[model samples]
Target: MAQTATTGTTVAEVMAELAALEDPRIREVNVRHGDDHGVNLTKLRAVAKRLKTQHELARELWATGDTAARLLALLVCRPKAFERDELDTMLRDARTPKVHDWLVGYVVKKSPHAEALRVAWFADPDPVVASAGWALTTDRVARSPEGLDLPGLLDVIEAQMKDAPDRLQWAMNHCLAQIGIEHAEHRARALEIGERLEVLKDYPTPPGCTSPFAPAWITEMVSRQHTP
Candidate 1:
């Protein structure tokens, strides 16, 4: 007989197959969960709805003692539990570096609302989060007509500033490079940020990522800025 899935099983049960609680478990479940490139997003939505309503499942993502389980659970929770309140909850209580990376990247690459994502991004307790969150504002300029706050983000990551991470400086500069493309006045801002990155091409190394980078856009800006 073929192994049959339970009809009455909860969506969580249908999706999550927990191995014994251990570091190795992430590898096991990750393969199983992410195996199909097209994940069953429908079922994931159901599970997220359940977790959003049930504190216990949500708590497991943050409060549970099982580390691997907790990370897996949070990973699932991201696609499913993206409501503003749910994200706020995770931002407030979830401290795992892995989870923060997932959340921040999601907000940067996927969110429909750039401003809303900015709010969620700032919720991270880590300095990396704060830096990335601030940098994200510039990242959105490429996708939005309202444009990015390049000077602000660039200022925050300034090398001469009181305290700044070299990685963040790189990242913010990268984002500025992307913003340079628009036929808008901010092209100057973009070149300024790109020149910053070019300066760092010889630096020892950096910590966090800089902002976004759009090579085509940066090239355009360089050409336009340099044209006599």
Candidate 2:
């Protein structure tokens, strides 16, 4: 029997530990690491689905175990890429607060999926869930065009905020920041969320170490905000 090695910090060391997984936990942990390192997006998404239903897959997910399932589940749903049922299933089983945020962030970036995303968001029982819902709403507001209905989206988010935790304000506002509101009503809702978050200063983060939104999106949001 091999004893588990205990002192590796680099990703390579981590993979070696995983490959040696006489221990089930170690295997799951390492699979999760591959995701953290640089596995392909579609492959990761496939792994996430298997983890959702299969024990062996779950073992692998747990190996990388760094929230790869959550990240992949969210990535699986994207504009022009995601279908509603898949998104629905992802949200339905995503008990982790961070997974909920990942779903919320993904939904906001998409154009046609808002209503379905709205349904799942409300279904989440956690206050963090509500905040993710609220934040995603802000995104809808941003991309909503001349003919799009802003009032409806605002109505949902505002109603959700009533039940959501105050700590979620920052995430909700950050969602708005991505959208860059245009509709007058949504603009106000975006501002309201932003102001609330700014005042509170404490955003409710989901479980796990990774960020929820895409790297490029963050870069764009920051660049635009900083621009004159």
Candidate 3:
């Protein structure tokens, strides 16, 4: 087991801890998800718990460009403190899936710049950036759907999702499922689109895990919502 940070919280010490925690097996698993880190997330979060929030330290750790260290930095940084453009730059630099996921889920989602960035990245030439935009859109679909063009979103998914790169395809599939589960008005069309496109239809889902195939995912979630 790697030692938890009980003493030093400086970049050098935290990075040393991260390097010490690396496991070849963990890296092997993470590589499948487009990540390159090996530190267990539970231990990383434990380290963050000891260090608490140190936004400046977070920046320095992120500057190191180490995957585990950036993951740690995300845990310790204040989300709302980042400028919009700074977040954009970080997203552009975050090429790995885990780092990109954490940046979007932990920081960008909480930042006031979320919507602006969502709109900006939605049509980005980079599929990875567009995937983040779709991820943000999925959040909005579930939480606040007031002014979003549900039909237009469905149209876009119907048109582009099948041919999108892996990450963007997954994100679009999520948005499709969210629309189907949350809005009864769009449920039928969402399911219909999913069935017609056949995206992720053959994906191997682990036991008791819902398929990322959109129609099945939508049906399972919607069923759970109505479960007694």
lDDT against the true structure, each candidate: 0.48, 0.46, 0.93
How would you encode candidate 2's per-residue C-alpha lDDT over 120-173 as one tens digit per residue?
Answer: 664466555555555655555555444434555445444554344553644543
Best by lDDT: 3
Candidate scoring better on TM-score of 2 and 3 = 3
TM-score, predicted candidate 3 vs. hidden true structure: 0.95
Best-performing candidate as measured by TM-score: 3
Which tens-of-lDDT digit does each residue in 41-147 have in candidate 3?
99899999989888888898899998999999999999999999999999999999989999999999999999999999999999999999999999999999889
10 residues in a row with least lDDT, candidate 1: 1-10
Candidate ranking (lDDT, best to worst): 3, 1, 2
Error of 1 at 70 (Å): 4.5
How would you encode candidate 1's per-residue C-alpha lDDT over 5-107 as one tens digit per residue? 3233343453343332223444455456333122233444444454444424434444543334444455444344356565555544435444455455653
| RMSD, every candidate, angstroms | 8.9, 11.0, 3.3
TM-score of each: 0.49, 0.42, 0.95
What lDDT score goes with residue 134 in model 2? 57
- Candidate 1: which stretches are off by over 4 Å? 1-59, 65-71, 78-86, 92-96, 107-126, 145-147, 151-163, 181-185, 196-217, 220-228
